[model samples]
Target: MKPTFIILSFFFFGMVLHLHAQSKVDSLTYYYGVVNQPKSNIQLAKAYNFFTKQKEQSIKRKDIEKAVFHLRLLASIEKKMGLLSDSEISSVEALRLLDGMTNPEMIKENRIGIYNHLGIVYRSLDNFSKALEFYSKSLELVEDEASKATLLNNIGNLYLDKNEYSRALVYFEEAYEKSPRLDLKMKARVLDNLGLAQAKLTLPGALSNLLEALSLRKTIDYIPGVITSYGHLSDYYLDKGDRETAQDYAQKALEQAKQLNNPQYLESTLATLVLLNGTPEVVQYKKLRDSLEKASVRAKDNFEYYRYQFSEQQRLFEESEFKRQKLFLTLILVILVFVAIYVVGRVKHNKEKLLKVYETETRISKKVHDEVANDMYQIMAKLQANNETEEVLDHLEAVYRKTRDISKEHSEIDVEGNFSETLMELLKGFNNDEVRVIVQSISKVDWRHFSNLQKTTIYRVLQELMVNMRKHSRASYVVLKFEQKGKSMAIQYTDNGVGTAIYKKGGLQNTENRMKSIKGSITFESNNDAGFKASIRI
Candidate 1:
């Protein structure tokens, strides 16, 4: 064979591979965007197929990021479909791929996403501790208020499932406060959860929150949320000694559950109605609930079996990929040993220069957009005045100085050793003349047990929480307590401030993300009446 013909064949092979990979990625990205929408299972199934193909292509191309992305998507779909075991396997596989990559940022969002999804799966499987573990892991990685709010709510729900009503109530309140006003569905769910938790505790606002949640759900046409709300309302009214109202709401919930054909809600509503109305209908509802519960158990068993089979198939595919990668690596190593041994040496230098250029460009763009451009625009408005030219010049100078200060702040982070000491110092800084800051058991934690990275995460998390308290809580007293629990350390923070609604913000999100990166967990507790309390575990 001629050398030129051989080169042409290689080029064709490369082009074909590139096109195929691109196609798979495009398909996966498209499906990912719509996976959560109503009636999207069909599209998700198509996306799943593409994800499998992408995995194969990624393995062939030795692209760890792409492979992780594919596995993450697969896990998400599996979780959505109630295939908990399969979802867990896919998520673990994706996390494993991170070990081979230099930068995990490409799939950072997905990594935390899978953790939260796995938590949901575990929660569904009735593994409360495992669910909390995964949720905590996700909380550490959550960077946005919305995601944090969702995770907090999920954790609260897990506590609800565990029958820890007080713990659940804390998270529910935080989630309700932090969630955006625009997210009616989420807010309704939170309200419903709060109502349930409150009702369990026989709290004063249980009926109001539940009724409001039901109204909101009905307004938004969220049938599922409304159904759950009905059940909660029935429970609340029943507990309030109003059997008539309870029976009415229970019947309404049963009707909706029947319309939706949801066995879980059907069983719940039927059981509630059986207690409320002790007629001959009680016997029929009990029988129906028992039968449906049995069927639901069987269905779950079958789903698990199918998930097992799917996992076996995935295992086989991975085996094949491992073999293919081994052979591919051998071939590449042989070729590179001779032709590209020296070529690889300059790659790092070029990459570093490119990265520096990118960083500088990003900083300049952000400063211009966030500060310089807005300042200039204000200056332009002021320049419309006949005698405002000098004022405009002064404003421009101020903008420049502000921009320079911001740039410096952005570039430099106050990183210190001695995690406990640093944390104490930071907390002291927040302890103003009005705010009486109390530190408890700070010396009890064996900070030596944690690595610098873990310590740094702990410091930063406490700092963010305190900043939030100072900025929003307006509390006069703050308590910081540290406790060592077996191998892990826990920090409990409480504040007596005017606790307001918590929302997703960059600082809180970053704190969560930092904790997530270090596999630590943080929980926020607050209410309109009670002051704010936060618990951090590492």
Candidate 2:
């Protein structure tokens, strides 16, 4: 029973490789043929070396399809050599490469192939549940009839290994029905499996199907399929109480297994021959089985070591990438902080420069008013007392008034006092009998929130506007309106004067600059025969 089942398992694996090989191209096809059917360990080792180098080159070039192609062939070779654990690792690596790939067709095809290969690998490892899981996954991805038939056959083989002959027959029958889509070699393999499953259940017609499968295999010269057919025929005859006929078939299986040069097939055929011809062959079968089992154990251990090394390298690479990203963020944050500091310092420097210039102008104006204007006032009084020319006295009076106006324009105001009252006084200074000045909503504004720089800017800007209006505007009435909107204070000034088209010069430009220095804004609007208007906001 053991020898017959072993032969069945061997051919099932052969069928799996044969189906998988149909899709290979060019260099991959050449390597697969060499590795899959190696005549010696040295030949397999050379093929392994070539595939490893090709896989590495493909990975370096970012060619995912080519890398996975090499991995699939390498897994087939590893499983053929009884390195079940290594085969499992290779198949999983190939699947990992397909993960998150944008190409859906490529992902589906490669994943189906790897999943089917993993099912075969796990079955060889005696992990029946894992084998079923992979087989089901492969089945889900298979869109083609040939691939579905192949998976069904593999599933049937799994049930056969568990001795569930009835359940195995169901899958085998379905696979056989699907065989028209498969090639002649695959059809022979599926028919052979179907016959074996039926023979295990002692079903009728099993003998005719087995003979037919053998005849099909012979037409194609498939040696592995012929050996499997002979082994199954032997088991069927023995089950029916025909010892002599079974022995004849066992001898034929042993001859073919030897010619094939596969140690596993030879050992299994010897086990069958021992059952028929006793004693002599028992020792050889046990010795060969023990040697193969030890080699399989060593292969599993080597695969575990390789897997551990791969995991460690992956861990180190992720840790390095995480640190690199962290460092980059830290650098960006530092640069942003430096930029904020530079901007604040530049604004502070400009504000200080503006304040210094204002103070200097105030000092010079005070000097001119105290000495030069007072001297002119005393000269005018002396000319009046001495009865000098009336024209000279009038000229002295005009000069004194001009000097006082300059002193008042540059004078610093007491912002700590009633600033609204100070602002109104400054605005009303332009009023006379010919021109009337109106100040509106002056007390409505809350002046406590304003800084000294802001107060000085507002005072200077309004003074410049009034001086410009009084000097050039031949207007009868002037209006100054103040209001608070949101977080800002706004002042609007208008006059029914002959408005000039030319603006943004002399005192008006100076007014614009002063408003800007304190982060405020002022706009002038005028046209011929239209009223002059100035709007200020801070």
Candidate 3:
């Protein structure tokens, strides 16, 4: 795996382990609570005795304190996993069990050192008032700086969620001021939250916070966080009226999400791409959307398994009315899953098919350019090189021109359906020593016609575009246009050369003839210092 991927996997694994630990704790809590309940007094009393009873006489000594320690650790894990329900109940039970222990065991407040986690659960559940209550209580009780920092973070989270940016900043700032190692989880959380709150208060999308967010997110490979920052950056640029920059950042978010294979990120990206539908940036958005669809299908399959499990659980409970309702809900979910899966797949396939067609055309065009008619052209060059009789020389010239004409006459269109690749190749060739070409506006075009002949004519016109620029214009950079103007197609080229009028010869006049054959007309604009420019209309 790449270093980046390994790091991401590590973070993801940490998160996954956190979840598993939380789930195990939830299961343990449920089992223990059932034992402790008022309805099962006999079992509750037995289990309580089993847990509380300690032995110093045996090798395999029973340790109730150790068991409760494990339970406390589990509750902290639940709080980190965003399992608000599990964290809340588990934390309460852990606190209750830790109470009444010998003072030497707790030794100040070590026995039930987990109120910060309770605060976290409340924060996630959107009970900020309760969350702050728990956090303050924990702060007063815990002497450990790390635990205090965790409480501060929990309080910060509550304020942040409530959109109280100034308050949130204060909490995080305080947490950072204390021990940075407050949690086994990454330390960047404080910096990240600090930056976000700062951005909200300062600007719609401030640079400093966003840059910090990007650096940290990239370091940890936090896919959600990275996408979020990129999204903010995109919006920032868009709001600043830098459309290209905004568009670039937005599209980059789409690309990064696609590579990560995160369907959730892609879903967010697609909404942006749809907004940029007709622009060059839309291409990136479309590409990611197509990939997201494939992933969403797999997600649906997983959801189906969950639905099945839920159904079994409902059936076992013998709650017929609830079961009926769950069954209906399950059926509806399955259909929506199928439809979503189908739509995503269909969009993906169409994009693939389009790309394939583009590739095939490119291959054919390359063959014609480098392989076909090559030997004949070489032979013509060799024949022209020889010193011979006038009649023989005339014969040679006639044969060469006739062969060229024949090749030109029977020319078929080379349409590499891929505009992106085609445009790249065209631009590469357009750059040479004799002609300096400035070719912008080369991407994400909606071609006027899909006909093979039309594509062929356009390719030749472009080839002629380069030829004209090289031989005549003495251009520094060639600005070529392949655009649709209303009902007609227009092409323009400008260059810096000595002012000159139309003296049609070699490739320039020949290109003019070719243009006429395609029913296209060429016009020239020139200046003494600015040199010459040409535009063609079809």
Candidate 4:
């Protein structure tokens, strides 16, 4: 062949390979997004099929870069879907592909992504040491702070779980400070880890860190972290025999668990609730555990769903999640905005009714005190001057009867509206153009079920939450949900917001009181990069 023809041929081949690589990335992302939405196993099955073919074809083409990328994804997805050693084989294949790459920079980038994933797989397998080793390698080749910070955070968590508090803090703080960008989950994890470390140090920072992390989780809707943080706090208080504080935190954690639909968390929260001073915590624990066993079976029945739908289903799932999120927000706006208006109307109506009662009672009281009393006085004067004692006594009796009726009218209390309406309003307030919001609301109930005092208290709790989210959380997305199960209603809110840098607990006290007043409950979570989550159960 002529030299010119050879050069052009090579150029064309390289271009094809590059395009193919890009295509593979697009597919991975597309499929990954689909898995994020609500879907059936048919989807995952399709994704697994498509990607599997892509991986095989890439290997056959000797396109190592593309091959490894697909393999990494296949591994990760397999692990998450509960497929065992097959995922590990994919990771090994990814590393094998790397051996063929010659360019140093390209190799570094690929290796970083590969090793991070290796760490994920190993961590899932409980091979923490190997996970740590690969994560460290990924860190060494890192060009971006975000990548390094995430690795550091992961490493620190591994150490924390191993009970090496001091070592954990070193990496945790390093990641926290050096990380230019943070995620909600990462930040919450760091804060919670920091709290654990600080507690060991006996620093005032411990409580503050715990509280800050707890609060941030609430703002950003980091439900799991919120629940964990509360449990930690409850444990801290429990050890100290601060029954009141322990009970408060325990209750908060339980509320969050219910909101998240996490049976495992609820089980723990129920156990803690049993320990609270007033309730029969043991009874609640038994009941909760029995319920959890049943739910686990249900979850398991749906477990293989993701595996079977692995391909096209995954794509659809993500699209559905996006659409569902938008629809959720729209529904929230319609329901909560209307409910808020309803609450406001109810509040006004009650005030009006109360005022009418006050006015009528006042008018009657005044009539007895002023007009009827004067008549009695005149009768008494007549009795004294003209000897009419019997008439004076009769007038006094009539005046007393009128005064008693006035007292009865004024003593009655009527507060009849739906607390759900008020909660809906509070959630609706969190929705703004700066962020997207998804709401899943339970049925609205009659506020009349609650006392006047309870109504005011719960409203204030939700208000405190909205205020923190709007003011402190720079969240672009929020998820508000309400669900009713059996006798209880869970009002849950979550957001993806970078919230409080440290502990913020002043608002939580009010939140707790509001739930407690209505015999309801709350649980929440928050963090630096992710956002916050809180559940109010009534």
Best by lDDT: 2
Where does candidate 3 have its weakest 10-residue lDDT segment? Answer: 50-59
Q: How many clashes (backbone atoms < 3 Å, residues ≥3 apart in a chain or on different chains) does model 2 have?
A: 0
Give the residue spans of candidate 3 off by over 4 A.
Answer: 1-62, 76-83, 103-113, 144-146, 179-187, 203-206, 220-538
lDDT of 3 at 282: 75
TM-score of 3: 0.33
Residues 1-538, model 4: lDDT tens digits = 6999999999999999999999978977878754442133456666777778988998899988778777876776676565545666676667656769888887788778877876776665555787798899899889787787888878987786677878888988888786347666667667777777777656567888788778878887767678889998997787667989999989989987787654557778987787575457666777687678646533443322124337446768989999999999999999999999998887777566645644665677666666665676676566677766676667777776655544433332333555565456556655778867676644544444445655555555655776677678878887767565655556677777885444536777657744654457777777678678887777
Candidate 4 segments exceeding 4 Å error: 1-30, 34-50, 60-62, 82-84, 183-185, 214-538
Q: Of the candidates numbered 2 and 4, which has the greater lDDT value? A: 2
TM-score of each: 0.44, 0.50, 0.33, 0.39
List RMSD in Å for every model shown: 38.2, 19.3, 35.0, 39.5
Task: Single out the weakest 10-residue window by summed lDDT for candidate 2.
Answer: 300-309
Q: Write the per-residue lDDT of candidate 1 for residues 204-269, one digit (tens) a residue.
A: 888888889999999988766878888888878877898898889989999887876645567678
lDDT assessment of candidate 3: 0.61
For candidate 3, write residues 77-145 as lDDT tens digits: 444333456555555555544544565646346532665665666555555676687678778877677
As for lDDT, the candidate ahead, 1 or 2, is 2
